[model samples]
Target: MIVGMNMENQVLIVEDEDSLSSYLKTELTFENYDVLVAGDGEEAMTEFTEHQDTLGVVLLDWMIPKLNGLEVLRRIRKQTATLPVIFMTARDYVGDKVAGLDNGADDYITKPFEIEELLARLRVIFRHEAQQLQVAPVYEIANLKLDTKSHQVTRDDSHVQLTQREYTLLLYLLQHKEETVTRDELLDNVWGVDFVGQTNIVDVYIRYLRNKVDRDHTPELIHTIRGVGYTLREEE
Candidate 1:
């Protein structure tokens, strides 16, 4: 059992299949996670709303009843854009996986997965979230400041709005300022080591951060390392 498990570390399982849902609940509970089960999209949303503050992550089945997984994720994103969501689907198609990620899933696992792997993935997500919480409330570099407690970023006197993923990515870069951080490193630290998707996700989010943090700003703090990776440092 997990030591010191609490409501704040709870996980929500949204799966319509009776056998699978029960198995997940039992396994998660065995691991000492406060588990909440919902058998359909509607129920999932209801449970999410009721326990949003307590939920640490969501394990959502792709083909759930009433609203489908993507729709449920869409609604969830509207409410809390940063809430971690993992899509569980039997479909092995890359297109489906891409759609899920594009629609807001933080990760996706093909069905018939081993429970051990799932547990490991959950641990990674939880670890990353905990690390973020422990970060200093404010980080500043060359007039750019990030406030972890407020979830806000500003340059000079201008505020910059970012999606949760973007904010996390930028924070990671700032944490490793001046050092070239590889795509694999970013994937492992920011997206989790179990993440099984395109590495281009790093590039995509880098573009996003650059647009918001540096496009119109001076002394562009984010820099490409040319064939190596990327770095965040004041221009030389």
Candidate 2:
């Protein structure tokens, strides 16, 4: 029975492989994260439920005894939809990835991956989740309004649905309104330092925000600064 000492910053690692699990536990502990290990799905479920409130993230392995990772994740989502779960699996097929994602896995990482990358991903997840807890002052630009405490956004009195990442990105833009936020800055602030130049993820998320926040509204709030980055401001 693996028990977690520090509830704060706890991470549940659900991997059946003893060697890998031990290694992860050691590494994560060294990084100051409270680590809990469960060799099988049943143990994973029990530990997760017991420490759900304190758990920052779950590093879940796809293949496990009693219940697979996806099933465990499904159960976890049924309880808390926003809890971050990253699947660590050897499966690299597109179908497998889609299945994990559709079932509420927040991130997917293939096996034999770099420990540094895994740690980085966990940092990003924790950083994003931490932002959600902050008490941000209500922001307004023209007809758009965002209440960080309520975690809601409205444009012209219509509520807009935004993913956690989108909400964070928007909040950052509103905080720095009228300023061109460079891609690097966004990546650092929103996605964390680990995602500095890994593909055009920043651009992709910008499009996502625009589609929901500005696609139907007049006077776009998110503007592309061509060759520089993006800025959120009322039309001139």
Candidate 3:
């Protein structure tokens, strides 16, 4: 079981829009999340300070009153760097996305995005954090390591952050290390039978894993078998 998963199901929604905030609170509550709302930046900080320990995630709007979302996020980061914060903004510029990420947002969603997608992102953040807090085992290859106890990946002992999906995909590859595992096998095991629509997801995630786990490292561990699939093994 994921440690702290059940203990931290609360989320703070920092949006000034009444109708949208109310609607979101109702929706999230229905999905079993303890909902908290702060109409502006100051209130956002107050709510967060009070519930910092219990809070699992934060959904912050970019144009909130008093401090603005960016300022609020900065302040929150000072208090705690590990708390997950996702920016909800109307801005979709590449620069704006980079700024938010640089300012410590774990994710970003444009104003018109589907609620299901937002919920999905929240679930991913929760899963990742919960897994990080657990105590388990460690797997290693070359200079890379994955600690199941903390759900953290490290290269030469330096920490690497991964989303829940990416972590799961990596875990599966490690379990089948040194074997050329097929995409179909990966989808069946990693994405599961319910995964429909595309087969390229495995490829996409493999690329993601490479960028994080192998890019700058020597003796790259993840290898593609061309027409076959992929493998995780030490290459001499």
Candidate 4:
């Protein structure tokens, strides 16, 4: 879907309204997501069954040509044990939203929703799923082992203790190893866009990462590129 992104995640949109389904498909595709459109509840179920492994989330409409939203949600919940499903309906009534969530929908987004809001919700769902999708994140370079899932790091059989901010910062740097990562990019992505602070946060975290992961090492792992940003790599 998105260039350079893993297509292991898929989203299904079930809406009988051809116009609405097409619009969603286009918008999601532009965001680099693998999206499938199902015209009705039955079709949605079929797609879900076929792509269960890769189906990360679903957007189900309230009324469809073949089966109604509630019935579809019931069938999906019975079939999909831990799959995330979001209800999309024109009915903005509080009762309808409550009913949908009570019946197992992960979230209920009313129709005429803001595109940005929908994207934000999808991001949250995907991130939550990703955390559960991986058992561990063990990244290694040379004699060092970084266990992001466990928040632990070890070098040459010796345990390296790091603060929460340091661990998170190192993991982020390691994930994008060898790339020049900007301070603003780090602030926005790591702490979230709404982080009520300045880019100095990145500097503070970088210092922490340096102390824990690089101080005793021979060749520096984290390199500061003047006028640009930082890079984490094995290269000198």
Candidate 5:
């Protein structure tokens, strides 16, 4: 078992190969990991939704029955932004790698990788998560409250439904409360360092966030600076 990460948190292995799945499960279990196995893409989603709160990492196979790994990953990102996922794919094509990472995979390993390498990767992921795992009290600006632990946002006690990307963008803004966050900073933090998309992607997401966070709300919190970037501050 890993020492830093909570042992109660499980690693979900989504693999249809019985032999490899069994091998991985045995190895992880021997190391004190709580393991959940899924034979196909659909089952992976079911297990994910059922145990999302307790899941620590997901070892997602690229090719699976019912749905491909990329599709499964897209669905997972739709629900939560913080969950760490590592793709296990036999294919080493550049496009495939880009698709997986672009879809929010924390890391990926080509198939036939050594067990020690996989464990090292897991440790790195756990270390990163440990930095942000501590639950904090809700951040409130005006009537909006965002609970980082529960990943919930509310306005005047009314819950707001935010997509995974939207939630991450909002959370970053709240964490930097009352500060002007530049597009470069937002791209670096929210979109990951390897983001190769158009620079306007930041502007696009800010627009998306404003529609949900400020629209119809009094004391609008998201504001644009003509030449700078954006800030989340309550205004009269």
Candidate 6:
């Protein structure tokens, strides 16, 4: 039974041990956390990329097959600017801990950690994530404005209806205006790791956002970057 509600955010548990991963998954779920499990480093990367949008924290084992937790954490950090990652591994070397944090890990946990300690760390990460998201400024390009706080968008003073996914995509593009945000980046950052849908989903959503926000406007805000990806900026 759960000792308390998991007011902390969703977590992805990346551990190769079948028993430990399953136990963590069950415990976290019962405590009200949304959890995903990946047994290998490659799968962990895939899961983290796919679920990046909704994932608030990651519990990663430092040593694993395929990519290994350190490599996986590095890959995630390369794309995601400020993700909160906790290294839960037996590698307790000070050098290991420094390297992990230097490479983008938020915290480290040694093997045989108590569940309560894990929960406390998770709570800290979740609180930090919440604060960061709250402080991220709203982004705008052309006539489109996206208020990150409200997760709402408006085009030319008119409400442009968009699905939650659509809003996420739009906001991401707006954040990196003028530069092309790649399809793989979108797949990882917006749709997330658990999304098993077609890669073309990005294209479809782009079209939808364009039609709604730019179909009638004299200047378009979203531009298709041909083979690369999409860019959100003022039209030339």
Top model number, TM-score:
1
Clashing pairs in 2: none
In terms of TM-score, how similar is model 2 to the real structure?
A: 0.70
Clashing pairs in 6: 50-192, 50-193, 51-192, 51-193
Q: What is the per-residue lDDT of model 2 for residues 111-143, given as tens digits with 9 covering 90 to 100?
A: 888999999988888766665565558999988
Give the runs in model 2 whose Cα sits over 4 Å from its true position: 1-7, 38-50, 64-81, 92-108, 127-135, 154-161, 215-219
Which ten residues in a row are the worst by lDDT in model 6?
1-10
Best by lDDT: 1
Q: Residue 80 of candidate 3: its Cα lDDT?
A: 61
On residues 75-160, what C-alpha lDDT tens digit does candidate 6 reach at each position? Answer: 87666534567889897687787687556565577888788777766665565345536565877776778775554577887866
By TM-score rank, best first, the candidates go 1, 2, 3, 5, 4, 6
The C-alpha RMSD of each candidate to the native structure, in angstroms, is 4.5, 5.4, 5.4, 12.1, 6.3, 13.7
Cα lDDT computed for each candidate against the true fold: 0.83, 0.81, 0.79, 0.72, 0.78, 0.73
Better of 3 and 4 by lDDT: 3
What is the number of backbone collisions in each predicted candidate, taken in the order shown? 0, 0, 1, 1, 2, 4
lDDT value for candidate 5? 0.78
Spell out the clash pairs found in candidate 5.
Answer: 1-31, 1-32
* True lDDT of residue 89, candidate 1: 95
Clashing pairs in 3: 136-149
Provide the lowest-lDDT 10-residue window in model 3. Answer: 1-10
* Candidate 4, 1-236: lDDT as tens digits: 11111126688999998888898899999998899999987898889778876777889999887788888887876654346677889997867865875565656677788778778877865664466347566887766788655445787768775533355567678878889999887766555464443566577667766776778885678889887779888876
| Candidate 1 segments whose C-alpha is farther than 4 A from its true place | 1-7, 155-164, 215-219
lDDT of 1 by residue, 110-221 (tens): 9999999899889987886677677556888998998776666889878776655676788899889989999999988887777767888899789878988999889989
TM-score of each: 0.86, 0.70, 0.63, 0.54, 0.61, 0.54
By TM-score, how accurate is candidate 6? 0.54
Model 6 lDDT, full chain set: 0.73
Count clashing residue pairs in model 1: 0
Off-target runs (Cα >4 Å) in candidate 6 are: 1-8, 132-236
